[model samples]
Target chain A: MNDQTLFSIFFSAMVVNNFTLALFLGLCPFMGVSARVETALRMGLANIFVLTLTSLAAWFLNTYVLENAPYLRIISFIIVVASLVQIVEMVVKKIAPVLFRQLGIFLPLMTTNCAIFGLAIFQTNRGYDFMQGIVFAIGAGLGLTLALVLMASIRETSELSDIPAIAKGTGLTLIIAGSLSLAFMGFAGLL
Target chain B: MRTTTPAEDFVRGIWKENPVLIQMLGLCPALAVTNTLKNALAMSAATFFVLTCSSVLISSVKSLIPKEVRISSYILVIATFVTLADMLLQAYAPVQHKELGAFIALIVVNCMILGRQEAFSSRNTVYRSLLDAIGVGIGFTIALVMMGGFREILGIGTLFDIPLFGPNFEPWVVMVLPAGGFLMLGFIILGLGVFEQRKKSREAAAA
Candidate 1:
């Protein structure tokens, strides 16, 4: 397989094919945790951390463990992701309680974020080697962070504006996300 | 938990507690695969199979799973069914399977399945869990089909690939794209909100 340059992979994942805006991988938290810019940034950092770890774990599993037993990919990936998040949560709680408090339930909830699983699966399917997979995860995590920060900042301002009764809450957030997705589509030519 | 009738358990998930429209659970597949009616139907069918089977299995085996590891156990059960569904689709409907891609496997992480297990099946009777799963599954299918129908008709001027408009009909290309999925669901949720408000006001006026 011809490997894509790390820069291209990073740039593509960050903007051209952003995980949240383009791929629809992690909309739950993209919507749920994006209400405030500060929280969103913290969540993004957590995502980046877990995603990088996931890349390492998934690569190890794919190259070493799952080569012969491909059917076990889904199950093993889920277990690995869940436990990894748990370990991260515990570590964060131990080392940085302030950040842990800010992350709160969202940290643990990352287990089902789908973006993590999507990243692992995509890396495997694309046959990304160790370095490529790690770069891709970092790029995706940054992409997600960018989307979250943008949405959260806009939402912070929108709170003062008069949204229609019908378009408040989730409806408004989703419409905004749709617009963001449209804007991101402009970057499709970058690759 | 308050006691409820079987009918209530089944009906609530369809409307009052709709996993997609009301609760906003499991949105990735709802938005990702609804670009076409066929893909949406296949995804929903696969979800229904996995959800129903896992809910039944989990409820039946709830006691054996210790509280500390119940979440893991539930995931294991759900992942098993998802794998089965994935393989079944691969063997039988390879085309649809390819269209669905990793989404079929991603079903293992779908919050709806895990939520139902933790919230309902783990506590409720097997019969009630079955009803709840069926109701939620049907609700999800309804939502996906509605979205798929809307997107397919506008994006491609067809429903299930049957041309609805004349050959001259122009398609709104965005309706089939990722942006369109978000916009469509946003509008749908908005419409539902308006409907709910009117119903509430009407009831207040009557009272």
Candidate 2:
């Protein structure tokens, strides 16, 4: 792929084809941690960190491991990612309690987020090099953050709206998400 | 023991604490695979097999598992069954194997299976855990199938690849897309809310 095309891949992945909104990756955290705006933002940042680091590590591992040892790639990749999440959790808890508290349990939730794993697999599938993989992860993580923050903002305002009793809480949220997804469809060809 | 039965354990999973509709766990699979009845049924069966096997194995050795490493143990156990399900699907139903992709691999992290182990199985007897597994598995399947049926009928004017609507009828393509899954879930949750409220009021009047 041309170097210029790499930048476009990164751009489209982040804004035009957001992982959470456009591709529906990482719906769990998008829905779960979005109950509060502050938590959403913190989770978004934490996700950026973990996702970028893991994508870089995963890219390097993919190149060396899969090229030479295809059989053990999946299992080894998962173990590496899991351990990396654990290490980040410990580091954040010790170094930044404020950030940790805001993220709370969600820090660990990153291990099973699926978006991270999917990113790794997607990068492998697309055959991105190390630099391209990092850019893609940054874009995807930003996309996830954007979706979470927007959903939280909407939910925050929705708390006071005159929602029918039967459609309060999750029902309403899902509807809003559906509409937002519809809106995001407008960006399908921005690339 | 005052009649603590395994049947009761199993039955509770079907209704009382369903991993999907009630507990609201495993929403990814619930939303992702419920586009068609066939996919839903396949997903449900795969989940049931994995859940049952994981429960049996986890419960049998719950006491033996040290508290510090329980999560890792559960992951290993769940991963084993996920591998089995993945291989079976690949060998027998290659089409579905392609359709499901990484989501099948994602069964290792669905949370429902692990949540059940952490909540009920770890402390219960193997027979009781088996029953609970079946109940929850069936309950999860019901939700997926219902969602899938609605989407297939409305979104594609078909059910399990059979055309139900006349040729003149135009399908709402949105219903077949990912957005459709969210919309269907929203309406289903709303309907359930209305049903629950009505039931509560009726019970109150009777009382």
Candidate 3:
């Protein structure tokens, strides 16, 4: 396990193994919430914060508490992520109202984002230690952020293109995403 | 809000409120599992089983659960059923299970299942919830099979491993890949949109 270098994991997770484009982790928000660039950026940041905490807590529990009963991993990990998101939501609301209004509205939905859940599940399956798990989470979060921001930028411009009437909303976004997914495939050789 | 008929609840999920094509929920498995017909069918069956079983179970127990912990309870129920389905597939059909890999467990995070439990099962009667679950399950399965058929036919010139096209036909490799999944889904949405609009305009002109 240690043979795989940290830089490789970070780079692969961030680009070659993106959660949305490459792995199809969080397509709902990748499509639904990516209407504007600012909102997408906020959602990405919020996901990074929550995902880091989730990876930390999930790794701790998996290593120490639920070491024997691997079957209970999913139920326990979900509770951990959900509760963490709730805490982050409230804390963000009280400490920074402006930030809250910008990103807080998207926190609750992040619970079911699948990318966060996928992060914990992947790190667990990969058997990453503490420091390694955090690094992987950061990479995954940044990967998600990059995908979201890029999709938002394209969709924002999509409005200007003289798109066919039938392919106005999601149809057009998906076609563009397909192209992006193809482009991301070029990073496959980097590893 | 207008009260819906029991039959309406059962029927709407297939198309009008279809989870994948219309609402855009559960896109992960839709794209990942549709490369081949068998995997698509297996994934769809597992999802349908979990969604329908959990919907009924959650609905029946909805009253006993407190509001504060309802969401957690829902997760527990959904995860338990997903595990059961995963185990069943692994034991009986190891090949499909291997093909599905982590996506089976990832079903726990699918917004459609959780969304249905929160939006429908948590409030409705068990029978009604069951109807809604079956409807959505069938709808999701139909979408999977549709996309899988499209990809399989184009990618390999075969459906369900049976040769449909002769040696002259050259398969488009991209259709079997992840990129093709997105493009196929996009074109389907576009076709549906165009069909719906044309029908609307025709009716308007006649009226």
Among these predicted structures, which one has the highest DockQ? 1
Q: What value of lDDT does candidate 3 attain over all alpha carbons?
A: 0.89
Q: Write the number of the candidate with greater lDDT, choosing between 1 and 2.
A: 1
Residue-wise lDDT of candidate 2 within B78-116, one digit each (tens)? 877887888899899999888877678777667788889
DockQ, per-model, please?
A: 0.83, 0.55, 0.75
Better of 1 and 3 by DockQ: 1
Question: How many clashing pairs does model 3 include?
Answer: 0
lDDT of each: 0.93, 0.82, 0.89
Q: Which parts of model 2 are misplaced by more than 4 Å? A: A1-4, A66-74, B1-4
- TM per prediction: 0.98, 0.93, 0.96
* Candidate 3 ranges with C-alpha deviation above 4 Å: none
- In model 2 chain B, which range of ten residues has the least summed lDDT? B1-10
lDDT per residue as tens, model 3, A25-78: 988778877988988998888888888999999889988998899888888888
| Model 3 lDDT tens row, B30-136 | 99889999999999999999999999999998889999988889988998988899889989999999998888888998889999999999989999999999999
What CA RMSD would candidate 1 show?
Answer: 1.0
Residue pairs clashing, model 1: none
- Which candidate number has the best TM-score? 1
Q: Which ranges in model 1 have alpha carbons more than 4 Å from their true place?
A: none
